[model samples]
Target: MPIHNADIIRIFEEIADLLEIQQANTFRIRAYRNAARTLQSMDKDVAVLVEQHADLTQLPTIGKDLAAKIEEIVHTGQCQALTKLRQQLPASLPELLKIPGLGPKRVHALYHELDIHTPEQLLRAARDGRILALHGFGQKTVDALVRSIESHIRQKPRLKLAEAAHYAKPLAHYLQQHPGVDEVTIAGSYRRGKDTVGDIDLLVSAADSQPVMAHFTHYDEVAKVQSSGRTRASVVLKCGLQVDLRVVAKPSFGAALHYFTGSRSHNIELRRRAQQRGLKLNEYGVFRGDTQVAGATEDSVFKAVGLPWIPPELRENQGEIAAAEAGELPNLIELRHLQGDLHAHTRASDGHASLETMAAVAKQKGLRYLAITEHSQRLTVTHGLNAEQLRRQIDQINALNDTLEGITLLKGIEVDILEDGSLDLPDEVLGQLDLVIAAIHSKFHLSRQLQTERIIRAMQRPHFSILAHPTGRLLEQRDAYDVDMPRVIREARQRGCYLELNAHPERLDLLDTHCRMAKAEGVLISINSDAHHPNDFDNLTYGIGQARRGWLEKEDVLNTRSLRQVKRLLTQTL
Candidate 1:
């Protein structure tokens, strides 16, 4: 494979870890690690850098030796030094190094002195009294290592948006409390409203950089200050999450935030726009010459370059630039435009709230209508509703609607899509409900062709009103099963079924790319929170973000219609 910048950066990170295990020279090891971070964050492609400059050794933090090594790695599949080190060490050594508290010195001691190559081998050594016999490795150390390994194995790979928000909120508050700080904002993937975040980026505007930098190192949540300087600081939190903080003057703060909080592709498009207008843009500001044109606000910056202001959510560089220039960016769906939620659960399923409480909460949120979409009987573990129970629930909803002053409740069910591309509920039972959300809750490992066919078959059903979380992804936790999304959108449009832009931060399924593709196929989208509780309705902002990225207009989203219009559309579909 012809490696891209991201691929090369990952290789460098692995090389740095292996070098540390070998007890290589501290400066050389630091060089490789720094190079990896720098490459990962660079806005431009490394291949372009290599092509333009033969001596990458001349680049900052890269010398003649590392530069040559990078060039070789880019051209070929391997590096000589990395290959030689791997040959001398066990293949499992790299995996073992990922264990918390196991540094290069301890790893070398275990390999050379204890002959422990794998985590299993080390665990056995700890149990058999061999680890205690080694110098500097005592009983407490062995116990700690075992605990660390256990924690590592048990920990899930991803965190939900609500979960990540909890961590960022406190840190943002702490940074804003400093006297020198003028403003602080969280940027990057989180700011773009991604469901799960890998790391958090905080940008601050400061009257004085030194004091703010000093205060950042002393934050209570900070486990260790990784790096600090006059303009930037990086620290690892107690939760093992890394946070990067940058301080800039008030005048340049907006531009700096835009530059640092990027998906790289977004920034590239911005830079290209600047270049075409005979302007230069950087972290400082956009300038026509030495005189600054725009830097105080993102809108002003874009307008100065002859383009309309592109919303942050739409700044993913996926055709947004051209759309902005042409004055044709879609009027995206907004949170205030949603009149009802189509997917929600109560105590009838695994949800924590009851039907009455959920309905009350929805009314409080100013919603005109709400759907109680408990899981179907097939999901026994979730206490999904049986056919008889659904009848009772429908009566309850009708009674609630009669009693409630301004809000109406709809009878809804989240019917399961079976293995053979049929719904768990029969047509007669499904027809009795006001709304039906068909979802694939299991068998996600099916092949692309099979998965696409399976979903299409369900959409073909007359009672299947909406397809919930089309790809069934949980952000960093699970890769979406391969499905021909363009085809799905076409089928849904042809069959008058709605494609949901699920608002649960963890499952913003059918991501922005697929959403845009769906719109191109004339498929109407529904932005639903799939809320399990009242608080989950807050996640609607993320779904709006996804909708904006997809260039969704008011007409494109079904929820943007009035309650009467929506009800009429549903009747027409049936």
Candidate 2:
């Protein structure tokens, strides 16, 4: 636990990087960066000064406040201000500075103007000509960036859907407003609600293809116009997301959407259906021996193939064709079906907001209940709460619940499951809460059998409620640790506990496929936004998308139930 001068320098420099990304006051940002330099040059260690009760303010750029912060980091191996800023932004964002062309100002511009947050996003932008679109970046800069990101993400690809949407929505609206553009619909895997989209496909219907294509290629965010034609155009947004736009006639709009908004297998199955009926199905229209049969509506397209219109999320050909034939397509879970969020946080942990603020936002978001599941001790980096602090938080939640209306706060702890399969908090303390969300914060390198047993043993423990972020993956930043997922899902069924479909865009754990496995096993899944801030509750949208993709119905979702039902279910786990 020795806090070396290098440690202070690194922390100071990171503080500067984070502040620069936020576009914070220049002088304050420079002070941290300068102090990091000051420490780098100092012959003596700052730790020894703290040990000897020496005055740090005497050092250059080390004011009283910063000196105290350094002392805090030295003593506890953390700084409160640093921890708070990290919670406010994406944890991996500062790492972007490691890329060749990304300086602090460019980082701010990329984040504020484009919503680019990760090295993968940066890489995607560079390849798609987005980075070169910046005001000061040249081909040389973007080229180097491409090299860095390519090297950074050699093992990672595909930006998350939420990241893709940051670029897709605005561009769609931009084209929708152009005169003569009749309809604008985003298609492809984006339309299918896949967790990650390789690219965005957009379909537009208009009488004049020229103006539509012109508008699309000339979009303000376009980094490069790869191709342009009378009816089709391809461009890369500055954010590195590729968008393909096709301007079809109003007559072919529905069929175009159906064909373009497809999983290839699903489209093939539809073609087979049309061929069986002696018709042809294509993007232009459906025809029988060259006689137009259906061309104007999606329902018409489905009707031409003797089937009902299927929801885009279910168009993966995963029994949906047969399900539609039998009138058994699932009434998939929607955002509105959720009545509560079983996991969230407040400033008492690494979260940015207060308990009341998070509660108010949850109520605004139409939730009947919000579980304040702050991280328990063991995640020292998060300043996770200890037993006494947790007991105090329980009392605080009870007091707030008494005065609140329309929404209740459930007391819960996102306690870490130790490597040996023991819960971080004593069972006595954990038993007092309304729920316990057992999680694995470390030992990600454990063997598959060890990891699987670690989780199963935790589930078997008394009062274990939900297994949070079961695979412990962080999207592009990290891989899901080795574990036997089928055994984990099957074990949850026997333990009478539930699994969390963590809705954090970065960690949408319980992958859609695992969700189906759990559903088949009759284990209900709780789609909770492991929200650190109030705005994070919006992540539930992504969670619902994942659930629908997994073919989960409302009955299979834990938070979709009434609070009374949820409580009864929680009680059964005890």
Candidate 3:
């Protein structure tokens, strides 16, 4: 099987996890972690680059040694360094890292102190109160671990939408190249733009199922062919993503797509509506008694049900049917609807690109304005800006704006919202910017009431404009902090502040439900790229998907307004 970019990244991540567990060189461990992140964000396939003999070290954060390792993995399908580490560590030790609160340090301690190498053993230790005696494992920590372990055991693994797309797009394209394949569509939660996908459901229209099944099962990325038959095949990819392929006739393509791209609740309601009309709906077509009424296209299917075609993103049975019936479905937000980005980063903080580079990319992307919201001093790890640095940056932005055309740069800071509800920077310092984005960087484990109060207090600040990544959740990594978001949304409305839908793949915060809640409270959302590099601007596409899923309209988004209008709104809070 041909090694894929995702496959290489997975190996790097595992190597990093194992290295950390073995108390290896910190820099070596960090190199692997950084390499994995760099690969994950890349749109280009590293395997193809290796085949082209391209210099991988030219990529971000990739050193010559790491680049060689990547090339080795791409060609050999495994890394000898990772294999060596695996020899010294238990194979299941890295799996413990997936459980929240179990860092490498703690896992090391557990392994040496109690010989708990697997989750089952860890669970037994926790249950026996053995874990509580460890250096850092208190009763509360043990309880949390027990709960997390049980949840982990029960839940099937899911990939983030962006991660899933990394694997899905190439496979779909490969299928399209098949000789007899006419149409190929990816259904399931992926089609609905859900933040996470459990698996990929691919429906294809082909003249004969035999050729299609052969082509799919023989793909280079397939790690295992679980099943192969005339009309359907299921395969697990090297990256551990399961893909189910089904072949449908051209006449039934739309119906099959509709059936496969479903929330069960939405499908049930549609079937109920079909029943009311004395018709039967199935994967093949809509039938009135024995005669076919509609099936050629998705629009025809909806028309047969006496409704307009609802966008897949809103097919959650969440009042979408009612809205469609009333002809009141929103023209949901799209990537093109955005006029500007309200949050971005530069080399001034932890970001990788220069301010000019970021602005140029935004201009190329047809944006009217871009906010440079670098981290404030409280986040020292990012070399965050102190008062003097922020003042200098503000002046730099002012000078740059004077020379630039077609795109304006807005001065802003992602100032930390302290535990006591205080802004990281002084009011006088914050007052100088075009806007202020307050965020909770620490104290994530606070009580819900405290977390809510902390954010509300920040919103009360006159210069506060938006709450960046409002929930502070890193998808598939850390859960969202406990906060009364409904209360926060209402407070934001009262305070004339906005909230951000961070477009960064890992932190697509201000989730769909929160976006809807913000809309209900009349608070505008700023769907921002939170661009740290030029390529990062592309992440806005995911944000737009999330906005559409939330049923947001152009009007519900703050950056959809013109620059002047945005300026006016920014000043409202002040």
Candidate 4:
């Protein structure tokens, strides 16, 4: 197979790890690490570099010494240095080094002391009482290692948008404070508001690259500085999070951010559209016959391409390009469009915010109404409301409604769906609520057929106004419980039950594709923040992105209307 830059970089990184474990020369190992990163980030293929450039040594960070090795590896499948290192260290040792908090030094110690070379072997040792006896390793360390192993095994591979935002916000703040940084914003999956993020991307506009690069390396949150250069820097935080920062001049900042923040598919579609008009779209700027036509803002770039500006969420290239070309893109729902939050919580449930405080915060956000959708009695962990508690909450909500100035508090419950497809509360209890959000809280591992049936059955209930967090996914933590989404959408649409676009970053449950699918089926989608606290209301943007990606119009969303209109829709469904 022809080798790619990505493959070669992976090999070099493994070699560097093995070398470190072997206690090789520090500079030699660092050279390999540097070369690996440089290759990984390059736009061109490593094999192409060797084929086109006679002196591959000219490549950044790849001096004559590293160049020869790279050339050998590209032409052949392996390199002598790497092969020799593998011989000195079991190949499995390099894999072990990937575990968080376990580096080459620890790997070396574990290998020599306990003959541990694989995760399975290490786990066995930890469980069988072999790890604690080793020098510098103890009972606490063994227990932690075991827990890490279990977490690694159970954890989902993606990160929720909320979790991603947690990382992006701090980094963006840090970059903005840097002396040379003119402006900074998060881009990519984080910007689009996907439930899970593969990596956190940041774009910075700087007067000079040197100061920005200096500040990136010295950031306090950075656990390790991975790579730093004139135009870009990549770092790994203490939380095992990866952040890439790109610096561009003010003139090119917008275009660069747009290009780099792309889903590759979106960028390709944009370039293809530009090509049809005899123009070129790239990171630096959009060009027509060597003249820079658009370089500053994303809107100009789209105009230069002869299309109306598409929102970031709808930029996934899934019919969006065609829609933009035809000027048929939907007027995607916006945060300002929301008249109220239909599913929120207060201290009555697991919510930290009080009923009065939650209502006041919603009003502060310009909402005309807010629903206090505390958990039903099923979720004891969240202090779910029982009959007595529900009555008390109803009274409090009524009192708050009377006293509140700008917002009305609606009595609501996020009632759990039992295994047999029944609500946690009886029909009498459910009938008393102004809004009821039916959700599946347990038995997530049920078969797709059963899970879909479970949710579809809940939607059949006249009292169930909304289906909350349809997928039950925690970004970077768990996969969506298996469910027949198409069937669920069809059934929900048929029954007039709204499918929720949960705004929680960790659970943007109605993902873009699902949202599009639901829209296609004529299902009404509700973009809800599902805010547990006031600050979480910010996540509404993520939900809006999903709605936009689905090509949802203002009319398609139930919450986009005024408070009276929303209440009317809810009543009609009831």
> Best-fitting candidate, measured by lDDT?
3
Model with the higher TM-score, candidate 3 or 4: 3
* lDDT by residue (tens digit), candidate 2, 1-574: 4555666776887898899888899779867865775565444578899999999987755799899999998899888888999999888889787664467888888887778999888878878887777787788668766776777666334767766665677778889999898899999998888878888899999998998888888777788899999899898875566789899998899999999999999999999998998999999999988788897888999987878989998898889999999998889999999999999988798676789988998999999999999998999867799999999999999999999999999999999999999899998898899999999988676778999999899999998999999899876555688899999989999989999999877687889899989999999999998877776788899899889888899999999999999999998987
The local lDDT score (0 to 100) that residue 114 gets in candidate 2 is 76
Better of 1 and 2 by lDDT: 2
Instruction: Name the TM-score of candidate 2.
Output: 0.76
The window of 10 residues in a row where model 2 has the poorest summed lDDT is 36-45
TM-score of each: 0.72, 0.76, 0.96, 0.70
lDDT of 3 at 142: 87
Backbone collision tally, model 3: 0
- In candidate 4, clashing pairs total 2
What are the per-model C-alpha RMSD values against the true structure? 17.9, 14.0, 1.8, 16.4
lDDT of 3 by residue, 482-535 (tens): 899999999988888999999888888888999899998899999998876677
Per-residue lDDT for 153 in model 1? 67
- Each prediction's total of clashing residue pairs, residues at least 3 apart in sequence or on different chains, is 0, 2, 0, 2
